[model samples]
Target: MTILVVILALLVGLVGGVLGGQSRGRASRAVLDDSLQREAQAQAERVRSEAEAQGRELRAEALRVREEASRLYQEAEVRQGQAAQQREQAMADAARERADAERERADALRERGETVRERETLKQDRQDTKRERDELKREIERLNRRAEQLDARGEKLDAVEEKLEAHEKRLSEEGTALQERVRSAELKLYEVAALTPEQAKEQILSKLDSELEDEKAIRVRAMQERASADAKRHARHVIAQAIQRSASETSAALSVSVVPIPSDAMKGRIIGREGRNIRAFESLTGVDLIIDDTPEAVILSSFNPVRREVAKHVLEALVQDGRIHPSRIEEMVHKAQDDMKGFIHTQGEEAASSSGVLGVKPGLVQLLGRMYFRSSYGQNVLKHSVQVAHLTGIMAAELGLDVSLARRAGLMHDVGKSIDREIEGTHVDIGVSLGKRFGEPLEVIDAIAHHHDPENGETLYSVLVAAADAISAARPGARREELESYIKRLENLEHIAVSFPGVQSAYAVQAGREVRVLVQPDKVSDAQATLLAREIASRVEQDMEYPGQVQVTVVRESRAVEIAK
Candidate 1:
């Protein structure tokens, strides 16, 4: 306003000086000044009115947001109440359906009063007591099977809930990202709005800022509450895009390293004179050389991939050199052992480079290289680690965290898997020790220790690493659980179900995918049985690690029989 008035006064003064005397020019100047002042005051008043109107609108919006929140809260409460009532009604209806069965079991049930009242009959009934006990035991075994079925059904429900949660989480992440974009755009618009007479605009904006402070605080609190409640699901959401972006072609192949030769004659050469050359190579490399009937290919079998790899290298070199004598086999085996070190080192370097993680120790790098030959659940460990690193880095970048640290953590998260077969402790424990030995950051070590259990993690990076690891493992064709592990999971499922109170027995069927739990009907009420199924499913989710899904089922039964003589 001051600048505008100054320019206008300069123009009026020049015009008045040219057209009028000094006195007349002074009077014109005074009139122009008064009119200009009045106009400026009127403009200021209009601006003030506009600012006040905007403030009112903002206040109205805040009120509206609060009202909407309240409405949502009330609606959620109503729905929960309705759901509770429906569950109760369902429970009541089920109880009524089981009324006859319950009545039949009443006399046999533990009742001191009935026992005393039927004391005279009890002596006569003693003869059939043993038969009744055997029958009761069989009934219990049958009910246990029923419980397992219910447990399986509950597991399916849990799987459905997991999918729904991931979908909801994806939507939530999209919404949050969109909100960030909108906020940035708003800031740019605000900058543009302040271009003309910045002081005036700033004055209004300052008032607006002051007014919004309370609202911003309220919103921040609400967002924090939501974020805390959905931390794990949100973690998954952060890496969803990363999973879609990942490209991994590595697959878990059979453990046996097949060495191909030029022809069947080459196999005879590998066998050596009376097996001396072959025996020498096996002794040095600790790998079995199998001259199989499979055309021109021979099999190199060893439980240790490193040893098997060395044997494969040595055998191939001997075949190429056309020297399969005992002396030649020993020399070739020694050279192959030396070459194995450089090969694994190169592999480790390539893995680090692929993962975009630098400054790794030589020892750690070698460990990482070992992972190329190591696998778990039929998935390549080094490749899985690299994929995890990509995913973790992406999630960290999305959340505006330390991307390099996150990537490093992800790349080394499974380093223990490389030596876990030879080590004494779990992969997680070994990974943590390796991280510390390699001078990794505390965050990296923490993430390595807790990537499989995010709830125990202390840092956001742990959550990111955990999410990334799960995605890498669970991706299509990423990993295949071996038959032994599959069977073990089934056994664990049955064990877990049977361990629960009132469960007579449990059987894991459907190829380890489902469990049938039979519960004693007298001990477990219908409602309790339902809750037990859910509990068993939850326990399964927490205690076990299995691909795809496991369903748990619980079955309860009560029957009455009458005989006429």
Candidate 2:
């Protein structure tokens, strides 16, 4: 039984061992499977990662290729545009060539026609000369024939004269005897009437004086009427022509320059910390920057326009760059100053060129450029000078003077205004001094000196400049004055005319440009009226400070009335 039980135990133990082995095998297999699954998952993740990276690379390559294609397309478009522009330019060139050819042909034709006309005129003139020569010969022949006939008639007349002389002698004797009888009769009548020769001569002289006085009065009245009519017709025609020939536009200028800001916040930036930025800017640029209640605006003020301009540009740069500091401000100010010099020179060159004034000294041109920022009575001095130049040139052309010289004088006329603030004398004096220093011509210097108040004898060029200056200043909207000043000028003009002895009344007309004086006909003769007008004009010129010229017109009338009773 023990053997059998041991056998059973061995069998059971063997079975249990077998069961354990199987379980061990199963656990090892399960472990192997789990390890294989994990390896497979790791391999799959490696493949997925490789695939994702490849996909990303491919996408990147595709994007690069697309960008390259787009770049090529843009380049092509640019090339196409360039080609089109080139083609258009070529077409324009062709058109211009054609136009030039046509113009040349037309000019040739005109020249040919002119030559033909000249030949024809020459032939006609020769023919006229020949005809005149023949007519003169014929006239000489006729005069000779008349002289011969007169000689024959003189021979015939000599015989007839002998007989007529004998008859005339008898007639003379009879007349003398008749005159003696008449004289004797007159003497007897004078004795009987108790009259002497002296009294008769005195009466005759008085009658003659009365008749001569009447005739003199008639002639003087007729002469005055005719002269006045002619003077009016001629004066109107000349003045109208001068005015129509010159026309220009006027622009107003101000002393202050304005810079625009993007917003109110920029004001604080411009002010900077403790106002150091602004203070530095002003000190460097010599301009006052006024940041006030004015929204989005900054005002730059300085008597020196160049400094003001520099400050304006510097401020604009600081505001735009969003950097406001002392160092940056200084840098900008220096840059602005450099740029301003170039700009000012360019402006001067342009002004000189546009005014048709050539050969100007560079220094004078620079001085003239300063007028660009100057204002006189709200009128830009530069613009006014340009306008004067144009007007002067026009008038000079009409009057057959030197247009270039006139234009030069007009352009430089106001150059002194630019430096007047720095100089110690009047603009005229400074201008004259500058002109002399710069070796300007005598005429230009004279014009600069005497444009405002011409002395007793001013050059024609000076007069032209004065006239042009007046025309430019006196045009509508060209210049403006304070209301009080304008009114005072007008009142003064009228008062001057009224102060004359024979002036019954005076009126200031045409915005103080003209004064009309009415004189009593009895008190002022026609000649006296003319003198009075001149005297009034002279007085106004001496006493008043006015723009443009004043016209003095004196009126005198005579009336004759008859009563039909």
Q: What tens digits encode model 2's per-residue C-alpha lDDT throughout 1-565? A: 3344454465557556655665768865664655655665575566566667777887899999999999999999999999999999999999999999999999999999999999999999999999999999999999999999999999999999999999999999999999999999988977987778788778879999999999999999979976985786564443344555666665676568999999999988888889988899888988889999998999998877778878888888888999899999988888988888788778889989999999988888888888887888878898889878888787778678899998998898888898899869999888988999999988888888888875532677788788778777766556665556777788888888888898899999877778989999999999999889888977986799765467899989889999999
Off by over 4 Å in 2: 1-219, 225-240, 456-458, 482-565
What's each prediction's TM-score? 0.45, 0.48
What does candidate 1's lDDT look like per residue over 233-337, in tens digits? 564565656866777974775668888789899888787778887788889888888887999899998878899989888888888899788888888888988
For TM-score, the strongest prediction is 2
- Cα lDDT of candidate 2 equals 0.83
| Top candidate, metric lDDT | 1
C-alpha lDDT of all candidate models, in order: 0.84, 0.83
True-vs-predicted CA distance for residue 323, candidate 1, Å: 1.0
Candidate 1 residues lying further than 4 Å off, grouped into runs, are: 1-236, 481-565
